[model samples]
Target chain A: MSLIVFAGAAQFVGAGMFGMGVGGWEIVLTTFVLNFRHFLMTSSLSRRLPDNTTKSQSALAAFGVTDETFAVASMSRDEKLAPSYLYGLNFTAYTAWAAGTVAGVMAGSILGDTLKQSLTFGLYALFIGLLVPEMKRAKPAVTAALCSMAVSGALYFQPFFKMGSGWMIVSATVVGSFIAAVLHGDENE
Target chain B: MSKLNIIILMALVTYIPRMLPMVFLKNMRLAPWLNRFLRFIPYASLGALIFPGALFSVNPPAAAAGGIIVSAVMGLMGRSLIAVFASGVAAVYILLLII
Candidate 1:
């Protein structure tokens, strides 16, 4: 069960990170960044909660503010959300995510080495699936992606200054985001 | 790090963002520029994850390329997650069988 808790972030991007030889502090840090949107999600949902909600209850509700749960809770027709309703949404999502991971990992254990190696591409496929829609919608997004790909490729394949995959990923993220921010800076305009 | 350490760190790091705004920054507003930057994170991170690294995920390089092409096509076509994943793995699996 505790292992499954780590799996909360697994299905999304954790598998890819793990495949890249990422472990320990890097995994924790990457998970933090990946789930960073929860900050915005929780902030918005907080406004919908009843005025009398207690700190403890709010903290408890926040624990379940994943992307999926936030979407479900925010779409409720109620003008003011009760803690119980939010808890229900969170509980369902948490259970499904954790259960699925446990099932996936258990299944993976029995896979032959070659089968496991091929299946690793599933992680990259997941990442590409997440990317294409955004890139199609926005030119800036496409540019950012290309920027990241080029940087990551160079660092990954560089013979003289061969960089660790983890550092390569970190650098690519920074470079790509910087390009996108510069290109799309006046989004509010 | 140990599995225990990773588990603990993941929980702590993840919990902070989830809990902080709800309790302390409930009313704090993000700057528009910062929000815009945040929006790019997914694309940037995913892009980094796929290229170069993904290309080398499988041996015979050509098989990996084939898999990526399958993934890219399915992804651009707005296929289901399972479809995108299946096509990619299937392409690589087939390539490996042949070569």
Candidate 2:
């Protein structure tokens, strides 16, 4: 059980580490990029927080501003966001995530190694599931995703450029994003 | 580094971006281009994540192909994340069992 917890924590500690070899700096940078969306969430939610909210309180609240928690906090009916409410929201979401991870780890241990190996594909499938919704919504998403796929695939297989998975992923992300931003305009496609 | 160390590092990396804008950049306005670039980051990153790795992650080629196809179809159909992912994994697992 302790081993499972350690293994689970090692792998699922953050979305960025899922299904990848663990290199310290690579993990850190990949996580930073994965959670970069939080910048927008925090920016939006921070404004809703009470103007006089202390820096310490704001920082504390910011720590918990994940996608789910941010959505809940941002959707509150009250015009003014209370620090207490933000804290409660964050606490609930964090507890749920932690508990869920523990539950999964426990269940996984019971299932043993063969099934666990098969389940590794689940993470990749989940990534695909996440991307498809956005791709459906935006033309640029489709373009960028295809571009990323092509770039990453080429980097992985082509003998001339032997890029590591982490670096390849990051480079493809940058290129895809740059191309998407250039091609996508406010005007309807 | 140890698992605990990696987790802590993940926490720190995750925290910095979430903290910075709320702390110091609350009043600052980002350039329009930069905002648009950020807008597209998630999709692009997720894209970079899925390819080559996802397809090649599983064995036999058939299993990975089956899983990806099922997941892609479910996702395109607007299914929930869980449903889409489960279907994919299930497809792969079932395929493995048969072969």
Candidate 3:
């Protein structure tokens, strides 16, 4: 699944749903919604690629457009990102991801249940690590993040809101970012 | 459907969104409003991914909160990703041990 899907979040969500006996369509739909962010990442990245990059090379490079890779590539100081550079960046990340998965599987059996449960916190921590730097750069990102948390929290805990986790994230992100964009636009004007 | 079929479907769905934009929208310019919205997506998604769900991810939930605080502080300090992530995990583990 890791080799083929190559998406960490979607793989996690898919595995959880499968464990709980979710149907195929529901799983697919959830995965699609969760992965929709990649569209924005790839769109932004495409314009940065060198003009001489071939369609086939772009297609191959697109396969490796994970969040971590996109962040690294975007941060590069180069005026035009070479396809080779992207390939190397993506390949290294892909190797690390696959190797990490293997390592986790091997270590899972040796770990105690309590320790295993505690490790779940790492996922949230990773998110915070990804978010805080962005918040520092753009104050509006702080607003967006807070709004998302509020919306997501309400959707998850409120009895009136029956949406599943995938839809909840999608809804929260759209509303939160939309609000931030409006506020940001007003400030610019 | 079979597990194989499901896996194939997952791969398709995951790959299509990532591939289409790079392949087809390479030179297309985005509107300012849309660009603004896209800029906020990483933060918004990370925020949604962390909250409420993170609280319920571990026992007592305070452990998760502790990890979040540690990660946020370290991240703000311009710490490396591995350092922030490892410190957060270690904080959670230590908190759980104390609890």
Listed models, DockQ each: 0.47, 0.49, 0.65
RMSD (Cα, Å) for all candidates, in order, is 6.6, 6.3, 3.1
lDDT tens digits by residue: candidate 2, A7-117: 232234444454456576777665665566566557656666677788788888888776456544543557678889988887776777678778886897698554665
Candidates in order, TM-scores: namely: 0.64, 0.66, 0.84
Against the true structure, whose DockQ is highest? 3
Model 1 clash pairs are none
How much is A75 displaced in model 2, in angstroms? 15
Indicate the residue-level lDDT of A71 in model 2: 42
User: For model 3, how does the per-residue alpha-carbon lDDT over B1-99 read when each residue is reduced to its tens digit?
Assistant: 998899999999989889987887666678877777766666776788788888878888888888888999999998977888899989888888998
**What DockQ would you assign to candidate 2?**
0.49
lDDT of 1 by residue, A124-183 (tens): 776776677667767777877899899998887778875556566667866886788888
> Which candidate model has the greater DockQ, 1 or 2?
2
| Model 3 per-residue lDDT tens digits across residues A12-45 | 8899999999999999988888788777668767
Best by lDDT: 3
Q: What's the candidate order when arranged by decreasing lDDT?
A: 3, 1, 2
Q: What is the lDDT of residue B25 in candidate 2?
A: 49
DockQ of 3: 0.65
- Give the per-residue lDDT digits (tens) of candidate 2, residues B8-77: 7767766776777777644456776655555565566667767887777777778888889999999999
Error of 2 at B48 (Å): 1.1
